[model samples]
Target chain A: MSATYTAAATLPEALAALASGARPVAGGTDLVVGARQGKAPLPDSLVAIHGLAELRGIAETGGGGLRIGALVSHADLVAHPAVRERYTALADASAIVGSHATRHVGTLGGNVMNASPAMETGGPLICFGAEAVLVSESGERRVAVADLLTGPGRTAARPDELLVAIELPAAAGGSCYARLEYRRQMEIAVVGATCAVTLEGARIGSARVAITALTPRIVRVPDAESALAGGDGGAGAVQAAGDAAAAAAQPISDVRASADYRRAMAAVIARRAVTAAIARARGSSDSVPIPASPALHGADRD
Target chain B: MRYDAVLNVNGTDFPVEIEPHRSLLSVVRTELGMPGSKEGCDDSECGACMMLLDGRPVNSCSYLALQADGRKIVTVEGLADGGELHPLQRQFLAQGGVQCGFCTPGMLISAKALLDQNPAPSEDEIRIALSGNLCRCTGYQGIVRAVQAAAAEIA
Candidate 1:
């Protein structure tokens, strides 16, 4: 049980609380739920930062990118027009995060800091080359999203530091995030993949492929990207990229699926993501829905 | 250690001292003496403890009571206005949405939250909105029908 609690009204106050060894709670979805599940007890000293107004809103940067506050909820991201148009992969990932309630309260900062390998937004953030702005009492520093996430349920950030915002570079072309799930709502990814490709006329200019729930940390697959880049973005290239993703997967057996099953499904999910991303890049945006998992499943029948 | 805070629940203020780890569901039920919201699962997986915090649906089971200080909260008991039952309540009964009454409060709260934001929701939208609330007794067809009926009544 926690012995102390302080609801910080400002950013500096929250940072000071963190500097004083108080764990920050935003939305409390993961921290409180993890406590109930016996994964970890509530922190001895807690600071509620949900009331900090400075840590809210999504603003367009001068460089045509986005500067998303830590308190920006998944629901907000899904409803943002820029996210739907320019960052479709992020929209696809955030649209399917938990139920309506979870999306309403679960913030992007909480999700990124949680560092779950199977988290919906991690793959897309990595593929977009996002950066995490960590604020401390003394100073602020930015780290690439790929490097900030050290492992599952762990981050490279110190306890005294707070992740204030995520910075995304200007994006072009199309991207998609597709996950394998048993049910629609309140489900974690069994195996997932995010593919972002920029087309250069008839050929693929560049591609980034990241696999989720198939490794200790969500990481880009260089072999998979190499197979897709400089290709004609055809079925054969997509299939080869999928196969390379499967070859790079190092999964673990859990209640969701066996390691072998996850490895096998990695190729399928990766292929679906690649196919949908290519379709979007080709201006057939309606080919796949915002949340592409169910649409991809529906397409399997057709 | 406990902290003194006030929860503005259903337009009424209830000042109480609560522990930092206590959830809003427990504080609402135990301190405020309102048992309308049931605790099906202490974890957030089950939405039996759903409530509207500042007009947004939240799983009270996982929401810290202290964080809700000075915030408006609406539980199932607050759905009806005085003597007359809310349209959602009446429609839920008319559509046979209630079974064992275990998931009724949560379903009502979730439906109310949906209709407040989206006054006219499609059947698929209602289903997606209430996906957090689970009811094993009714196969969810009746609940879906109830939400649809209530939406029409309100519209």
Candidate 2:
């Protein structure tokens, strides 16, 4: 149990608390629930940063990119017009995270910093080339989202650092995040894939393919990206990308699914993600909804 | 160590001194004398401890009471106005939404939050809104009907 707690009024105060070894709590969806589930004990000391106005709101950065504050809730992301229109993949991931109540309170910073390989938003952030802005009493530094997440329930951030914001570069082309879920709500991804592709006429110019719940960390598959790039963005290219993702997968058996099953589903989910992304790139947004998972059901058989 | 704070619930402010680890649900039920919210999973998976914090639905079981300091909280007990049943409460009974009544409080709170945001929610919207609240007895059909009826009555 936490022996002491203080609600920080500003960024400097929160950073100072962290510098003193007090864990920062925002939303408390993960920290408090993890303690209840026996996953980890409550930190001896905590500083509530949820009330800090400096770490809130989403704003358009220079070059049409987005700077998302750490305290911005998942519901806020889902409700944002830019997130739904430009960062559709992120919207897809956020829209399906936990349930209504969870999304209303859960913060993107908490989700990213928690470093769960199965988290819904990590793959999209990685595909979009987002950056984690870390701040401490010393200074501020930005780390790539992919590098910031080191392992399950762990991050590269020091105990004295706090993730203040996530910065996404201007979105290009189209992207989609699809996960194999057992239920509609309050579900984590069993196996998920995110594909962001920019089409040059009929050919795919560039692509980013990331697999989730299939590796120790959510990672972009270079082999899968190579399979889709410079290709016709057709069935053959999509299949090759899926196969490459499956080959790159190193999943573990757990209560959700066996390692082999996750590996098999990785290819299916990746293919669906790529297909939806390509369709959106081709200006066919009606082909896939904000969350491509449910809309792309039975797509693998095709 | 216990932290002293005030939680405004249902337009009333109550001063409380609670431990840092105590949940908003525990503080409301034990300290504030409001036992309407149920603790189903103690974890956030079951929304039996759902409450409105600053007009947004949150799983109070996982919300730290210290974080709720000076924030407006709305429990199910606050739903009714002066011995009059809220539209949601009346609709739940009229639609047979309650079976065991274990999840009713959370369901009502969730429904209220949903209606407050979107007054004319479709069936799918209502289901998605109540997805966090688990009802083992009613199987959720009656609950869905109750939310829809309440929305109609309110609008």
Candidate 3:
């Protein structure tokens, strides 16, 4: 197991190394866990990007959208004041992505590049109209985040390409990402939905919805988006949009969730997410991400 | 595949070489002789093996010793200063946060990181933050109280 270890000081250097056949490692949370369980082989070389703190931040970008660096952690997502305030849906999605420990080390870029259908980054990112920024030895290009994932644990990214950053367009200031998972931390999403909506005086202007884990790749249900456009952004509208989104999904049977159950939860969660986004758009910026404040501790199961 | 890597554990640096198959938990207990971080599950789900990796809690059982190269790490044994218990360590004892004592170190590390970032986090926030770490005894009531109590102390 002779592996070349490289610590990238900049994104360009990292991209170049990746193009030259070096394995890119960021945070190494997911990859490490899988490796520990013998589910993967440690690549001969590990290009560590944890040293590049520049790639780990949440801030308002010059382009008027939120630019989440590849190294941003789940904890960083929850703790960032800017993220918790405006794009809280992203934070909410990050909070339940894993346990406190896992969240601290898991990187958003890793989640995106890993391309798991139930990837925590997929739904919320899609909700925000996020773009995937890829870099190569030749140059750099941007792709829609929705277009990045091809299927479960698959991506359209070239083997020699490295995902550098995730650019999420500012969705007129209100958005929400939600999903149903069997376990709060360990389970993958059964059906994930991201909704971004802009409201003009109780009337919805435009809406974007991306559903993950319930299909081959995350697909926007335009029929559901239409249901949310002219409606009052009220409970009924949200429910209808969720129903359409669920109806529009082409989920497969898997261990985590049945197709029927996923379809049902797809509607339920999409409606809930859209409703939540609308509520945030109405100025509930300080709303907490969790459902209940009750404290529950883990008791030993073994 | 053994290579000498610098591991900054509990503030001090130690040069060590380990097999790629070795876990950080085993390294901490055997090589370094710091056993505060337990290896209850040998899996990532249990917080019993939690430690601070660059100020963030991570399960050491699933963590390879090679991953700690040139990184700062903190174990439960490092929580005290000059033989004095950390507030969380002391508070866990006061509130019976430790029933089985197996999950205490991991719980404390997770709670410590949470409090380090958020000093006055709400009860629900505490639960959500520490949900991944498991405690078999006391049904987590005392553990949650211990975290809340520690938060109060830190505040």
lDDT of 1 by residue, A25-105 (tens): 999998999999999899989999998888899999999999999999999999998987788889888888887778888
How would you class the docking of model 1?
medium
- Residue A54 CA displacement from its true place in model 2, Å: 1.1
Model 1 misplaced stretches (Cα beyond 4 Å): A287-302
Separate DockQ for every predicted complex: 0.77, 0.77, 0.51
RMSD of each: 1.7, 1.8, 4.3
Per-structure clash totals for the candidates:
0, 0, 5
Candidate 2 residue-wise lDDT, A190-268, digit = tens: 9999999998888999999999999999999999999999999989999999999999999999999999999999999
Candidate 2 lDDT for residue A218 = 96
The CA lDDT at A260 in model 3 is 88
Cα lDDT tens digits for candidate 3, A1-302: 46666667887777767777878776666777777667777677667677676676766888778888888888788888777776677888787777878777788888888787777668777777788888777777899887888776688888778776788775575777777765566546778888878887888888888787888777888988899887788777887898899898898887777888888888877876787788787776534453411123342211
lDDT of 3: 0.78
